[model samples]
Target: MDALNSGKFAGFNLSLLKFAWLSQSFGGVLFGFAIPMFAAFVANSIGGKLAFPAGFIGGLMSTQPTQVLNFDPASLHWVTTAPVPSTFIGALIISIVAGYLVKWMNQKIQLPDFLLAFKTTFLLPILSAIFVMLAMYYVITPFGGWINGGIRTLLTAAGEKGALMYAMGITAATAIDLGGPINKAAGFVAYSFITDHVLPVTARSIAIVIPPIGLGLATLLDRRLTGKRLFNAQLYPQGKTAMFLAFMGISEGAIPFALESPITAIPSYMVGAIVGSTFAVWLGAVQWFPESAIWAWPLVSHLGVYIAGILLGAVITALMVIFLRHMMYRWGKLLIESL
Candidate 1:
């Protein structure tokens, strides 16, 4: 644990963070924003309602739209349409890979100052982006599409299993690793549904807020229970920070508390997620966007219910954690007494 927290690890984390920021920035401008803008422009110039879907898919996949143009004789109009990119998932996969690859190359290869400057500024980014986009379009897109279809099917089936089951699945997935692959997989399915203009009746959005908010509230409950002002004061900052992060749709904010006492915190977070998500689903809450933050409440179909679900979940989680902690403390005291 000490080694993991050492300066060496800290430096590595910093480097990785820098790499992620640079990659995401570059990807956002080129694929996320610019390409979609261009696609929309082209779609509009061709005179049709094709721009919305085209731009949406193009932006998601970070590629130009593949357009089909037709002249309608009755209306004397030129119409264009772009099918959703089969390779949409490739955009995310390739960008992440490219980011790490660039980092590795920068460390391993030394170029002359002029060449390095040129490559870093122009050559590398252009070539990598082009290569990734092309590969995604031609090769990876088909396979990615098949996988996307499978995931979509699974999610759709899950929805049919009734709200309770669906919410349970989503909540568990969201809480299992706290922003790890399982969480991302569930999120991807939710986003895919949104992209197709479908309202996903899911508790995932609610689950995202539960962990952090619940953990934060648990601290307050603990303080109230023990009347330990100094200890509570020390925890207050972290609790407040977690709550703020939860409002922004970040679950990782609860991670420190879970790490401190996994037995109590993890189960509490998971249960909170389940309860919140179930309530939200039962209330017919629908999320149009995959990322659900408190600020996006207006976008939720049932705004009042959504807010209620979150508060209920957070309160339940806090109480659970407080109860469990109290029990554990009592058991420890009993053992000490016996000894």
Candidate 2:
């Protein structure tokens, strides 16, 4: 905003882009390593004001526990052994709380000059770590389990019999968070079905490419349709990147678009992807090789229909996002004028 106000375009924040793409480009790197590390940095930066070593304790404490899933051979069932840690989320919340707490303590609490040395090294870090750890384990962790568990329950209930709804649910999950935990949950569910032969990859295949392609199309047509650019100069390149990634079957490329206008854009992606996936499944597009959409053209039966479904969804998303953005701009303008 400041850059735009200064009649300059913003730089493509490569750090933000890296954070968005890290999980997709390198498996398990986003939440597991990148997010936790960032969380630690966030905590440390805020808490360090009082010269307390919050980032160190925060980073170590924020380390996410690995999610371990196993199939019980004897029981013939999948067993998840990893306990869900709110480490990634907790660190964000706790960083603010812990940082301010230390800052407040440092400013308000007056200890003996001799004992003041103990305040930062011994007192603050230890105190903050304990508070953050306890809060993370008791409050954050349990809540996370409940939320993710609900997703599991929904996937479990939406069995193959409810084909349309099932497909909608799958694509909606992917659209909700781009490449975050919700998307991962849906991917895991779909992968299990694909492995067991309970479903074709058509649902997953169509869903994966829609957001990027749709968003790319939106950027291309925004000026022509709306007489204004939906994306600025920095985002223009990202649109190209998104379109390129669509063929490679990576949805993370559209993360910037979704994050930039989550309330409006996410729903657009969701509706579009669900429509596309449902259409593809209804059209009897059977896809076995779920790796790359363009390369797997040979693996997809009813190839023309499958591609058409993706295109239809992309068009819907492109139109919907532009309309929504224009409406939001008008609403904001009206509110300011009335004020």
Q: Who wins the lDDT comparison?
A: 2
Q: lDDT tens digits, residues 1-339, model 1?
A: 334345565577867766766865675455345434433443334423322333334344643334546798999999976534553365455444444444554466677887977756666555545654565565555556667667666756766454467678868888877788778766655554555654373588888888889889877676577653212244567888999999898888888777667788889888888988888878778776545786568768888888888889899888898887777776763111110
lDDT of 2 by residue, 1-339 (tens): 333355443356644555545644554333245444555556557656452355445444544533456899999999877564444344456666667777777787788999988986788767766776676556655665455455446755775546666787788887777778777656655653554355666777788899999988888898899777756566677988998998987889889887677877888988899998899878778886545578778878999889999999999998998888778877773111110
Which pairs clash in model 2? none
Residue 206 in candidate 1 has what lDDT? 88
lDDT values, one for every candidate: 0.65, 0.70
State the displacement of the C-alpha of residue 138, model 2, in Å, after optimal TM-score superposition.
26
What does the lDDT read for residue 262 in candidate 1?
A: 79
Residue-pair clashes, model 2:
0
TM-scores, each model vs. reference: 0.60, 0.53
- The predictions' CA RMSDs to the true structure, in order, are 15.6, 13.6
